[model samples]
Target: MNQIAPIRPDAARNLPQPAALRAGIGAVLDIDLDAIAANRAKLIEVAGGLDCAAVVKADAYGLGAEAVAAALARAGCDKFFVAHIDEGIALRAAVPTASIFVLHGVVPGAEGAMCAYGLIPVLSTPAQIEIWRERAARRGKNLPAALHLDTGMARLGLSEHEFYALANDPSNLAGLDLRLVLSHLAAAEEKDNPSNARQREKFEDLRKRLPKIPASLANSSGVFLGRAYHFDLLRPGAALYGIAPRADEPNPLAQVVKLSARVLRVDDLPAKTPVGYNGRYVTPAPSRIATLSLGYADGFCRALGNSRVNAGFAGQKLPIVGNVSMDMITVDASSLPPGRLREGDFVDVIGGDADSVDRIAQAAGTIGYEILTALGARFQRRHSFSNEGRLA
Candidate 1:
């Protein structure tokens, strides 16, 4: 593995700090590192001392997985979850000492990489168990792995029949070294939903039947369900990135990702002039409309078109007008105090007081998870997670 070097002084001198960068056609995404650590602390606090495993899958939900994983590791996270063997390999290379778990489990020809990278696979089926056992036996090795029992989600994990079979036959895992027994809650975020209790009961019952193994049964939302849900460890994904685990409460997680776009052109139009495609919005009076560089292609959902969403600048609100286009959205900037707005100025799209992941999702008719994960790849990303704001 190539060793990572410290940031060069020359590079540091040339690069603008996250807050100083100007937003334009090539606006950068500012990732707050201190915010990441704070968010992790909040999650740990909410989990009531349960060890927190950071989920770095989907490129850390499209915010750059390796960078996010490294930041979280430095902040005291030891366990990490990735969706595939390749992700596990990459994360292991990035944070070599961190315990990595591949949620997709073992594939027929992929066991070699798992062993090489020191990754643990979450075994989901009897077939996977048998294959892993055979491979370990052939190699004269006892590979460590975890078992995921399907409680109710039915998406992954062992079915009820498979669970019973494993429980009835201890010899099923005779030569395999099991590390953790885990299950996912289907409706943990929904406070009134009965599925949470149902899944918990099933998971507990299954745990009782199996030989003593450290258990993990919660995701982000499950951690908020209280200490009863915290078994041996808790896996948190969205919460660690600042999205609230529960839908009904104010977010406890710090906002770690911020989106800003530059104003391309500011136009002063006459009263009642239409803006955007098909006259979706018409000014009631004379207005100054600012065209922003971001649109649906940039992950700003088109559903926000014709809504009353506004971007903030210098303590002023610029209301969005007309339909959002593929590359631009016009915002009424007339209310801005003179000299407070400009063509070169940037508008807040996600972070900041005017908009958040939850607010943007509400405007887009989607969920915060989708909004965060769907953040466009075009934006240059500036990641910072340090006490003094520079990578050590």
Candidate 2:
């Protein structure tokens, strides 16, 4: 089986502020670097030893790509994927030697920067292919690139007509070294969705016409669709960050994000008193309400207002009540004993349970990916390696 060189410990990055200083912050998002590495390991193992690449696009889903990608590199990951050229440029410094593939491919006239940074581009269109080919010719070298075949997503990648157009005349690819041929699965998470099989068959049919090269058809959820979708390389993004891999099955990945918010204020309200914007929720009886410092401004969805989601405190569920505002959320703490929840105390906004992310996303009528990437800059971010001992 193909493998990376032996794992090496990554040099520690700058540490976060002291707990004393963090106490003044309104919220904190604790990231488990070890969990992320383990998730990558799990994906690799499930892939039956096929190479697994980390997708750190959108700053590793807004959890700080520099730190997350560095940690993965320490755990023996040699390839990383990002959505744009700028993202690849920023991540280049963190994983200096690791293979970084820009998923969005090269923007016109930016091929020099891509080559200068030693970043590979996933060519998704014939136009992109021609630009990369032109650059390779000018440099007098076969520049590395990946071909994306659009099976069903209709989002990016080469369409069937475009792909066959090049396939008919192989000379179109002369100046580029095709590293990998890949596609995106539209509904791998659904498992029973027939589209998965259709896309796989299409990919198989399309790839056979090209020079023998590694192909990737799986994303995070695609990994769970079983070996049929594993292909030659596995490109997983959200799964490494602990998002559930499937909609119906229990999530097998470890939780990596823990979000908590400080209680800015606590109030006691009498029966029938309206709460928050437009009085969406009214107290039925005497109620203790705690105002959390996190709100929609911090990426807590306003749709969660008066939803069934709850703020966690010492295993207690403080049901979120009233509307989620720009900078505050009100949760009913009447169930907690007096003084249990006080000003300055912290409550779990998300990531308390194994499925907290999924649960919260469901309540907000969105997906876990949105919840993660939408997190704003207000929270004090900390990355932990508590599971490092296992990897060692």
Candidate 3:
């Protein structure tokens, strides 16, 4: 067998920089774990010292749950909320000491796995409560869990009749340790929306009926609704990932993600030249078009190409001018002087600005959460951290 020769470090310098290769390599997703930690700390401060739990569901909003949960745990975040039992189980290894709560509770016959993994289920229905209570009784010890009350969202949690039934028949909760009672907010982002107060009042009224357990009624936007919604715990998901907490408001959280696409090729097309599929965009004048190595498949929404969005290189805003392809999109870079943007260069499809995610989401006709979670597996993900203030 022939052995390959090893290139020396000095000789390697002549070749394409792996550093450069990665910078211009397809789609790049740069995630700042430190910024996420900082965002959690900011939420904790905003909650006025209330226990703030990190929501790492949907793979930490598609940023990688293991890394995000570990970073939060190191930052002194002891409580974490995931949307599913499997998510909590997967995150168990990353934050062994943190309290992992499963927001969707457990399916029937899966109670053993929840306990085996030490995950607390958020019982949202009478059926789920009965299952947990039976499991606790079988185990001959109290199993910790959270009770979710339906405080106007009407999506999850026990209904008003069920809630009162449980309140009247406290025996239904026997053998289970109800650590927390929580509810979801529907329009916490709409500060002036009357529903917020109604939900708060409903949650308050419901909590009074149950045992005086610590309660949580605030989500990311709820944290901004002042101390009344703060309650005993705050579960913030989107805000931690740098999504704007409210519509039309400045995002105070540090930007945590920067997505860039590599320039694959550049073309010079004359006036009246049609571009992309179906000629959705036609060049009104001679144009300099740079093809990027990302599209709808890479989480760059196709609607963006139709909505007059701009990708950035240096300080120049390059308008996307064509239908988005599965693996490419063309941007008109004519505004920049010739040779400024080369085939190997990269441009910001989603930049580091706080509003970049929301802005692009609006253009794509979706919310930021969808934008983040839709990020495909094709991109190279880079997680970084910095020594900033402590999250505790």
Highest-TM-score candidate = 2
Provide the TM-score for each candidate, comma-separated.
0.91, 0.93, 0.91
> Can you rank all candidates by lDDT, best first?
2, 3, 1
Candidate 1 residue-wise lDDT at 246 = 73
Instruction: List ranges where model 3 is wrong by over 4 Å.
Output: 1-25, 353-355, 386-392
Candidate 1 structure quality by residue, lDDT tens digits, 1-392: 11122222223222224445533454557777667666667666666656889888988888888777776666677899999999998877668888899999998998788888999999998888988898899889888899999999999999988888777877888768888999999888897788988888888888997648999998988888878888999898987777877768887666877777788888888888888999989888888888888888888788887755777666666677888888888888898865667778888766763577877787787778898788787787877643432222
Local accuracy of candidate 3 as per-residue lDDT tens digits, 119-237: 99999988898899889889999999999989888799998889898889778789888889999999988999999999999989989986479999999999999999998999999
Better of 2 and 3 by lDDT: 2
Cα error, residue 285 of model 3, in Å, equals: 2.1
- By lDDT, who's the top model here? 2
Kindly indicate the candidate among 1 and 2 with the higher TM-score: 2
Poorest stretch of ten by lDDT in candidate 2: 1-10
What is the clash tally of candidate 3?
Answer: 0
Please list the Cα RMSD from the true structure of every candidate, rounded to 1 decimal place: 5.1, 3.0, 8.2
Which of 2 and 3 is ahead in TM-score? Answer: 2
lDDT of each: 0.79, 0.86, 0.84
